[model samples]
Target chain A: MSTNGFGNISIMTRSMAWLIVCFLVLPITIVFAVSVTDKHYLSLPEQGISFQYYEKLFTSGPWMTSILQSFVIACASTVAAVLLGTLCAIGCWRLGNRASDFVRMLMLVPIMVPTIVYALGIYQFWIDLRLLDSYTGLIIAHIVTGLPYVVITVSTALAGFDPRLEQASLSLGASIGQTLRLVIIPNIKPGVISGAIFAFIHSWDELVLALFIAGRAVFTLPRRMWDGINESLDPTMAAVAAVLIAITVSLLCTDAYTRSRRA
Target chain B: MAGLEISNVTKKYANFRAVDDVSISIKRGEFLTLLGPSGSGKTTLLMMIAGFVQADRGDLTLNGQTITHLPPEARNLGMVFQGYALFPHLSVFDNVAFPLKVRKQSREEIATKVRAALDLVQLTALADRLPRQLSGGQQQRVALARALVFQPHLLLLDEPLSALDKKLRAELQDELKRLHRKVGLGFIYVTHDQEEALSMSDRIAVMRSGKIVEHGTPTDLYERPNTAFVADFIGKSNFVSGSVVEHRDGGFVFSGGGVRFVQRTKGPAPAIGAGVSIALRPEKIGVLRSGETAENELAGTLTEWNYLGSEFRLVVDAGPFGSFSVSVPTWQSDLAPEIGAAMKLGWSAAAGMVVAQD
Candidate 1:
């Protein structure tokens, strides 16, 4: 095939890129294929394709409850994370000093620290606070883990934003709050939206933090999926994995679309 | 008193003084330009006037009311930033209506005022276009409309036309002057372009080393500069440095580089033997005919020359006395310039002014 305008990308390099995509996406494709398996256990369709597992996903009490719980936790945590993270990013961007640099670095500590280690720390803290096994503890843990994603995306967006727009807004009689609402926020809207999406996905797909803090009362979808894998070998598990993959892929696609639109 | 007053403003960053004890009172409806080279604190002083940069020591008052401590939003001044700073997300109409909206104006009022402001800049047709969609000159006009829509007490423009092409810049310069007159608002324009300042401003404040070196009408500063820095910065000038040799008549004679020239001054002449520097404009010196006489004359060989459309710029290498640059108008000069040709350059006593060395 011709390299076209891609600047002499060799056939081997193009094949390697395809190879990497397959390597990354093949497992999800397998899960998707298994989701339509005819058999009750985990296996590719043999007799015929079936939608029974998918039907079970929507109809089953435990799966539906877990999905609802996960949705609520993800949404609550994403809202909290976006609020705090966007404020922190704007503050650091405007301050533009060594101290703000240190603060921004500190906000990234949750992402830098190993997730299992942080989960264990949160586990201990939640037990002392008597919040373990509750919605509040799980949401708090998810928010903490989701914050770095929000901060990183928002900060990247703020980096491209011209500071003079803020000055122009103020000089034109915009109050500080008015400037943020009318000028700064609108200009950095893509970043904020990207951050919110990432934060939501971060909380939604999170397993380790949910495993540590969540109990029967606050069972999230990821924790339930983990339990399903350990406790049972069923096509329903494949169906759930396929659904999560689809949701994540679509969210990421939306992010890419919005970002490209901005460019 | 119905204008902006900036007094004793100083801005220090670390050890560098960005603006040093600058004071200027702008009369109502005056076009005052802060003209300087880069890093000359002209922009800093303008920022202080716009309430962006806080003065370490100063009093900024608008019409007898102190506004030194006021925030930028409270200052009620419109600023057209260096690069226009138009909101990318807003349409040209919305951008012009921003200040009015910020002040919580009614929808009809904002529409009427925005339409009028856009009409003022001849951008009513582009009201729906985003800033990124418009041409450079169009964006500049939008910025002007936005700054004026709210009828700000004063308008501050920081190198507003620096981003445009030469032809467009000239067109906008005339537009800005017309807008100033029509609106009758105080305009504090900052620029490093001397021609832009000269053609547009009623008064020009020449700044250097964080201080206003001199401030006067453009003609006054160009014709009678107070310092060597102002003379060289405002326009092209040849410097003749020497000590006062004799006080003859009302003017005095100064000798430098084996050449003596008479300089006319209304002020007291520097004491005899006192070091004095004279700034002689290139256009003031002319090529003298064989029998023609001038108050000061020098004979030199034409070392180099350039034909500049309407004028011939010749570099004459006068021996002992340094080279003198003389501009001869194409219409007035009958002599053809040639390299290595000896020529007599002459200028009257009133042509040179004694300026203090910066």
Candidate 2:
């Protein structure tokens, strides 16, 4: 009788976990199915599967341009964010006082505030600075939004790092910059890489800020996808979403592999 | 004049003084140890000397040059921190070669020097292994090698062996002493372990409450500690407090626990009727047999006893003086110690020393 009770509980938990996973993954699978639909509109294929939408997504000039623009912005903003955020985390970790703690908390405000609110706030500033509709403006805006991820990850890495290594380097005749480059940086490489990946994905998928500040001259991938959904229910948008899911999944897998190897 | 000099150094954290008004001059090739219990400012003093912690009021000179305001890199001191803070990402070879690389030494010189440093620690076979891959003792040797490779003016170690097991720590203690002899550079080591300090240091400075209570050679500090704290901290001691009653030729008579006894002092004698304390070692007192006598004797009942393989330890309860712990060698004692048996503990006049109460 006791064995039956334990077995029943285990079965219930296992079924519940599987149900939750299926509920979470069902929408992504639908998007993948719609991507290969044979129809011209947004419905699933009735007769046979088709590669027409995928081919169209590749061939279309606007789609290619938007993808390129988004890639450039993500790369630029990720570099800026990693550099600024890693330094900020290191400064906070080293200072280890109330003021630095307050500043570290302030870095997370961008992530905490609603994206629409941040977009409206930055839209006003971009207009005042006359930086609207430019690559520089979009890159800077994405960098501000991407910084918190980098700060959090790098700060966690620094928490586990032995502060004595820095002292040892300095005592061995290495200057402050030399210690950071040779000892500190190499030790925290995993955190920096994880931060860069998050920052890149953030800038790649961001649409609200691009919708607010970006104009005709600088259309990003998300902005183009948003326009496609509004102008027409095109299945090519489903193909774009599938491609985005693939890229994001692959990047996340690489990050997981790196972290596991480190462990 | 050609060694490190720290004068009137102090460090305060808010309301607390971590290291206060301390000064020490280390000779060129001396192995000095800052010995104390936890929170005794030994490590803080070492950090101040290493240029990691700034002194609130002091001057630090190295080889006749004032380096009080110099950064740690410019000060040119090597430090082996607690837990052997090796870079986890770098191999042993790269870790030891770091200082040479920082100075931009020729690649050939760096390789040869790194090889020699590894060879000194006898870790040449594992040069390519990361710090995580090495055992605790091996990692300690790597930290030592890295600190010595730069050939700094002085090497400071901050409780570097506290992380190891007892047997491993004992092994490294001998290794460190041999390395100190080989290098011939001044070493300033910090630790709370008294045995480690006594066994390895040329001179030991005992610290308490951010102050150096006494500093001397190992034997001097052990045999003639000036304070009750040092006597108790360095080794096991039984403190006996009394008031001086008379002055003798080379000693004084003190009435302690309703018993008068003579205590000799090489230093100035305490005034008559002044309260005083004496630190007596347990091993110095012996079990007096029939017809045997000593300068001081206390009769009591044996309340507890233990055989420690090499010696027999007995606690005797004297009526007025409370309990006196006496240790007798197993070979010297023919009678077995039984609890509640009458015993007479005896010691010579010089076995106890006058010590100041903390």
Candidate 3:
């Protein structure tokens, strides 16, 4: 190819890349921009920034408690999902039979089944267990919703590991338990970390399951946000949303950075 | 007493019998190689011995103790996989120390043994490096050091050198033999490379279709193969199909394609008019000049020639016998052979033997 042709191709590629970046980033940028508006109502860029709405959030609203509750719920639900999902993935990978396949599909039921249907069933089930409106019920619901992410991420990670490493460890006089702990878990570290991140984000941002299960005692961030937008038109909701976006962005950036380091 | 004894070992998966009834005894401190192509049950037999796979109708004994029902960990055997299987997250020192640490050795003991094992493989300086930090050959040495560090009673290697380049493979082949001697441990090495088996093994068991077709020392199998399969697999062999004509001088005279060839044998000579096959190694045949005399000579024309550095491999179109090959030492050649050049090929009767067709 000629130099002029190469130059033209390079310019075209650079513009195309920028187009894609803008397409993906524009909505999130707009969300952040709108969340910090000085106006009392949601709108475009404003003349100044103010902490009045944030102060109102702390003094008059239950937003702080809901944020703390969301953090607790996300942490508990993520831990539960990661433990169950890792074991399930390992079992399916080893057994590789119809029964394991059935288990895998069952675990993925929450993903394939519509959230409304799941919410209705879980709502009734929680009432029977006397867990409705309780933190335990909220945690269980989020765990069920987050389980599939853990399974998929861990399964993908385990796919790259050679089974011979396990065999080699066993042959070297390590028992099955030692082999799993020393060899299998170390090799699948990335997958487990990625899965934990996904599960955390899933639980943190989940709304429908919480709406069905958490009534009075358990008010998570998303639930409070839902009520806030419905009840009022204030700049404080924007500040809370801005904070949520920042947390989510930081978590996603950490995931991407760790994945790149592993690569 | 044998170091390891496998009696009538058989393995079946569904309808496919991966390892048919096979028995072999390996001696202590001897390097025995299971030589065969893929799906030939060599690896399956090794896995059975290593206690990774169960045998359907066999008992594996080590030092007169039956271990057919034992698990891999209980068997206390060292195994090197095809991929080396070095722990990527662990440093070379920790990798070699793992087996020892699993046995709950003291930290000072582990450190000493790990250093000594690394020195054996000449990887002492790389102890702190992770597996990925090392090159392929270095990773292979680390694997070997790990497998041998614990001084397990037996060692099993599954195509350990197959992952390396051809030249590196040859280099490691020598190191493996040297390690085998230094360690004085019974080693069951699995490979498909005929040259590796011939050079490193005290004995080789050649397998086909999940069965051992022949087993013997390198020279015994090469010069005196019991079957044509062994003859062809162990080395290059040109088979001549023919019928036995007469019994002569404790041997048999075979007539085929308008030529008569005599084969010396200690087994029952083939009946007259019975079909027979003769196995002739390419290197055993000599390209003869005019008036050159030998035990047997046949006239032929050179069809193609390949220069293999040390030797010239010529394909001669011998009538009736079809195209036969003769390897000529390049250093001894007075003149290079041209394509279509008429030549004479000769070999002693003892060089070509009557081998079983199967």
Candidate 4:
């Protein structure tokens, strides 16, 4: 007698969707529960609730430094990507359709190829340039990886933009620069912000490329977290994962909120 | 405040000439409507005048200053796009105030001007709403207000009312005319609707294949179109192609399909035996009753007819002379039409105008 909210979709597919949702949430839930466990080693929440691991998260110098470094790199790279990528998208949009499409595809090179391959290529290039393991090198690499996200989102934003709005502005005595700043930019801000969010997230949890390219000179949070996991089951690791999940969820929620605001 | 002269303006796109040596002298405070079907280059010509498009070879002078190479912003023209193109994010107030803000006007000046513009369009109460929050007609008014806020020298509208429903379109048509009169700004309006052009414009330029085939007052173009295209495009006209049999002071005789048609022309008459087409408006041709008489008359069978409320549009088939549409008022007590019934169609000699074949 009940339609199960799907209206016409079969019960099998509905249950499958719920099953997938649970499957996805289970690991995060377990890590979140483990993060609060009172035990010394990593274990489930059969023990008493403890703030000890979370306390360690804030107190540890090296862990805090890694987190701070990640934040700096992510902020720097997100800024660089959003600016360059948004401008690039505007350039492509002006170039007209076919050429714009080709340029857009070209911008996606970093995203299209395997990360390890591009990372290795970038490492060789940076090593030759003597920028290896430097903040500039890591930030540049992060920007290159993040560029595609900003380009795609801004391009998508520009897609719905009525070009006549620009014409209307120009005809009403605003220069091209004024039109972009006053009209085009604000309309596409949601896209640029979402792109920034993606770029930040991309740089924040980047381990593979950072692992190959960075060492002690630039010890990022993910790089340190990866090392901690490899070395030992530090209960602090569960706490870090829980924090990472929280940060990613918040970033995604912001993206969703902005996207819905746009709609 | 300004009169713009477009002299020999032309735009070529690869193999096609989008605007071909098109020239129109838009007088100060004139409401000129460029009426044409799609691909007739009315939009292209409008774009050229607005400085959005660079003419291949021409000179555009606004108040005697050559502005052919000027960018749109430098031209200081107002334009309303087909979709209204209101900024979705900005409120009606900000949208209307954008020009003043970009020019760095004082906050007080911007508020006053924007308020006046909104009030002009009757959208003062809804100034705080975004474009999406408004209905189609409201969005249109906002676009109008935004363009008019700057008090531009000339206003260019590109099929601005095409997006609205029929009733709203008629309402805005009056609104546009009232705004033009109130502001006294020169306006260049583009539309494909003949009725809209006829009712609203001081002068209508009927374009065909990248050229202004006819440019005149709506009544002038309607009554005396110089070309077959203009006659047909400006309004419904029944064209009869033939060779001139004789040329005279009052009327010229042209014969086609075993029927000799007499047409009136004020211009230089074509020589006898020259090919030409006569354009006759449907309303001009009346039903000749039993004793009624006209300058010219033809007998034909009514093949098709449509009841157009105020009048009946009958398609009369005159054998080899071809089918002609004749509009007869329903109130007139005369020959009532029935399918396949033979009837005599008549029009004065002045009703059929001699139009160029090309």
Q: State fnat for each of the candidate structures.
A: 0.98, 0.98, 0.83, 0.94
For residue A104, what is the lDDT in candidate 3?
A: 80
**TM-score of chain B taken alone, candidate 1:** 0.97
**Can you write out model 3's per-residue Cα lDDT over A1-263, one digit (the tens) per residue?**
56666555677799999999999988877766766677878776568766666677777647889888999999999999999999889889777789988888888889999998999999999889999988888888988889998888888888898888888999999998898889888888888888899899889888899888886889888988888789886667777877887888888898888788778
Candidate 4 deviant stretches above 4 angstroms: A1-5, B246-249, B264-269
Model 3 per-residue lDDT tens digits across residues B1-358: 6589889999999999999999999888988999999999999999999888999998999988999999999998899999999888899999999999889999999999999999999999988999999988999899999999998888899999988898998899899989999999999999999999999999999999999999999999999998999998998898887899999887888888888887877778889999999899998889877778777678888999999999999999988788998898889887578999999888887878778887
Candidate achieving the largest DockQ: 1
What's the lDDT for residue B302 in model 1? 97
Q: Compare the candidates by TM-score and give the number of the best one.
A: 1
DockQ-wise, the better of 1 and 3 is 1
After best superposition, candidate 4 residue A20: deviation in angstroms?
Answer: 1.7
C-alpha positional error of residue B83 in candidate 2 after TM-score superposition, expressed in Å: 0.4
Candidate 3, residue B155: Cα displacement in angstroms equals: 1.1
What is the lDDT, from 0 to 100, of the residue B299 in candidate 3? 86
Report clashes for each candidate as comma-separated counts. Answer: 0, 0, 0, 0
lDDT of 4 by residue, A112-210 (tens): 999999999998898888888888889999999999999999999999888888888888888888988998999899999999999999999998789
Give the per-residue lDDT of model 2 (tens digit) for A1-263. Answer: 56656555677798899899999999898999999999889988889999899999999999999999999999999999999999999999989999999999999999999999999999999999999999999999999999999999999989889898999999999999999999998988889889999999999999999999996999999999999999999999999999999999999998898788778
Q: Candidates' TM-scores?
A: 0.98, 0.97, 0.93, 0.95
Q: After superposition, how far is residue A37 of candidate 4 from its true place, in Å?
A: 3.4
Worst 10 residues of 4 chain A by lDDT: A1-10
- Model 2: per-residue Cα lDDT at residue B48: 88
lDDT per residue (tens digit) for residues B1-358 in model 4: 1599989999999999999998889998999999999999999999998888899998999988999999989988888998988888899899999989989999999999998888888888998888889999899888888888887888899999998889999998998899899999899999999999999999999998999998999999998788888888888889778898998786688888778877787777788889888888999899888898877888999999888888999999988778898888888845566899989988887888777887
DockQ comparisons of all candidates to the true complex:
0.95, 0.90, 0.78, 0.86
